[model samples]
Target chain A: MASLYLIGIGPGSMDNLTGLAVKKLNESSVIIGYKYYINLIRPILKNKEIIESEITNEVDRAERAVLEVLNGKTVSLVSSGDSGIYGMAGLALEIISKKNIDIDVHVIPGISALNSAAALLGSPIMNDFCSISLSTNLTPWNIIEKRIMNAAEADFVIIFYNPKSMRRQNGIVNAMEIIKRYRNESTPVGIVKNAYRDGQEVILTDIKSMDYNTIDMFSTVIIGNSQTYLYKDFMITPRGYSKKYEY
Target chain B: MASLYLIGIGPGSMDNLTGLAVKKLNESSVIIGYKYYINLIRPILKNKEIIESEITNEVDRAERAVLEVLNGKTVSLVSSGDSGIYGMAGLALEIISKKNIDIDVHVIPGISALNSAAALLGSPIMNDFCSISLSTNLTPWNIIEKRIMNAAEADFVIIFYNPKSMRRQNGIVNAMEIIKRYRNESTPVGIVKNAYRDGQEVILTDIKSMDYNTIDMFSTVIIGNSQTYLYKDFMITPRGYSKKYEY
Candidate 1:
């Protein structure tokens, strides 16, 4: 009866690792993750066998992680942002469900990329907004396009994750094009580079002025719908109170 | 010059508190928070003078938190949800901007009611969603109505904070009416009771079946817009996928 702990260690900071999460990490006999995440928590691993895999091999990583846990090792798998968001929890559980394994799995939620991004950008997420990943790894392009269109049409404040990567990166451009397909071009867009990490940079731009090429694997982009506004050095996606409050 | 640390202590779980948040909390000498939240973290506080205040006395709490810092006590004003999100940071800064206070005010981020509610109900917030508080105490209904209309029209998943209290409870029905004004009556809804607490209960319903009377101070109600669907065991809001993926 091996148990697997799928933990979401809040965005990058070491202190973000909850005391419970750190305890769970210390309890694990083997730890599996992408190389960077493994290295991030290496100091506290405490005699746990570490399996550091590449980012692209998430499915492979899960398969190996499951096999190890099934072999009676207390296993802990990690992801940077909350595990459920873009992490491997869904896929892992899906695999477990398929295998009919009765193993117990625990998911520890971490601070997601957007939450950190939103924090760095000074609360653009304070209003009503939605988050979408521009990655088509498991999700398709046409659906992503429609989601973007629907979100923009819904006048949602948008937070985009997985904006771009090395090989397949034009999703941001297509996403913006779909957003502009329904929303006004004058909307404000805020970008967080390496959010919650050292050398974190924040840039505010307009919807039409977005430079797709400048955004890479480390950036999170937030686009405000038509009703979103800025005041006193904060970007606000007003949920319609500006006119009513003025009086 | 005295410095104020605006730390973002995550949701109720100690694991949710980040390393940065701990450093800030420990560095402060005086802590001010609503009674409920103060009770949660009282055991962890060390060398700090704690000020437990009720929710209604926010301005007074903020004033005292700032005043103590101004009086040379390293002060920390804590908010349960993200400090800046519909909480004290904005108002405190506004008051500080109006006065000549000599202390530095730091706004620490805490997990907002949104993520805490979402975690209880599996993946209702998966793709894109926005939150709007229907409370008229600080915001006018006209703005609330427009935001609801915009969010409903946008088909973004919606989470309502402070849905109903003793006096302003009418806002929930008004919000439902406004949402129904722009959306279908069959959209799925989820109400989380005492989210993250011991007696946590999640009720999955729809716009047609929602009743505002069941909600009170301890509950967090999440209403999914047009695209949100109700599964038997889970409240599934489509990120526009799930059809393509073989389940």
Candidate 2:
């Protein structure tokens, strides 16, 4: 049986890549990933045949990767972030299962951008949180709106992925308005720009006090729940732990 | 002013670590982390001093790392998972802020255990999810129960970290019972043993069908929400996409 490795390269860091992922990348003759993501790993790839695609062309990459793996060459498909989190792992598995190529598919997990971005800012994710991508690529805005409302109603910490681009800069404002409909305006908000990257910047603000215009495509916004507090300049979402609670 | 780097190592992988994190790691001369995590990257240390500790010793590690960084050495205190997710980034900040360290604190983001365990289990974490660590070291069970209730009520995809050990083998069963209070028995559950490492196994079961006695310390379990489905040997927590409104 032929084999395929669906590798998660993490949030663009070489060391954060697992030993297994690196071994697969080195052993596999063919590598498939988004062109931008491919560019990030070109320096590390050792004489591998790379297949790069655009962002919206996930199915094409999966198809090509499966075909390449079926040809009896150790082929590896790469995905930026955890791949399971809004990345190409699911789509690849779907296509692979559909093809039924007697291939042993291996998935090596990596860090998602949200966790990386959240780490860049303090403990904004220490509470019960939900991650919602603002892009309407797969789900409808109404359902997205309802999820946002449910998040707001439940006072769950909210992590907004794919926050904005030139065409959809207004979606974040709409999300904030909906959140404010149920949550307090003083709820803490954390914006991580290019988190875990060269030009990283972290901003801690509030829902009502946010300057929406400052955010962009590379930024991820983490809005804290009602009980989240800002202590010693850190955005802390208390897990409700401490010695005082031990009765 | 001296600075301390609170770096999230992201599941014992170098390539899975971020470029920004690598930059900070490169700058630091003293490294502090669990002995195993430090040993994972021993080749890259290049003669850097390491203060390795056991995984459970948090406050002591933070104090020692802070002291090293305060003494004019650039110290890198590493944590598995995102640094702030039950990690040392916050605890370090809390200690340093009180000591007047006049230090620059940088948190380098890494891959978290939730995403790693999820990716190992095929498409298990595709929808709304919350992560709860059953290690009640400092966190109380009452708050953990509330989070479980909230997750069950929201029908969120739930990932249980540190699920079972020799002493705490019943954590998942207790959590499942709490979840069953709000969720049904048919919800899909996935358990990934030894996630992101050698000898990893992914188990696909459900709330009513799972056996807790078989799990060990290395296992991380995930429970799918109401809309979750299993198709072609892959678990999917559909985000309510692929179904459009009839206008």
Q: Which numbered prediction scores highest in lDDT against the true structure? A: 2
TM-score of chain A of 2: 0.93
Q: What are the per-residue Cα lDDT tens digits for candidate 1 across B120-177?
A: 5655666556667777775567766766776666566778888888887687888888
lDDT (10s digit) by residue, model 2, range B123-229: 67766567777866656677667767766776668878778776776777888889888777888888877665667677888888998975788777888888776
TM-score of every model versus the real structure: 0.81, 0.85
Native-interface RMSD of candidate 2:
4.5
The DockQ for candidate 1, computed on C-alphas, is 0.27
Best of the candidates, TM-score = 2
Fraction of true contacts kept, per model?
0.21, 0.41
Per residue, candidate 2 scores C-alpha lDDT tens digits across A15-50 of 556555777788788889899888877888878888
Which run of 10 residues does model 1 chain A get worst, by summed lDDT? A238-247
Lowest lDDT 10-mer window, candidate 1 chain B? B238-247
**lDDT score for candidate 1 against the true structure:** 0.70
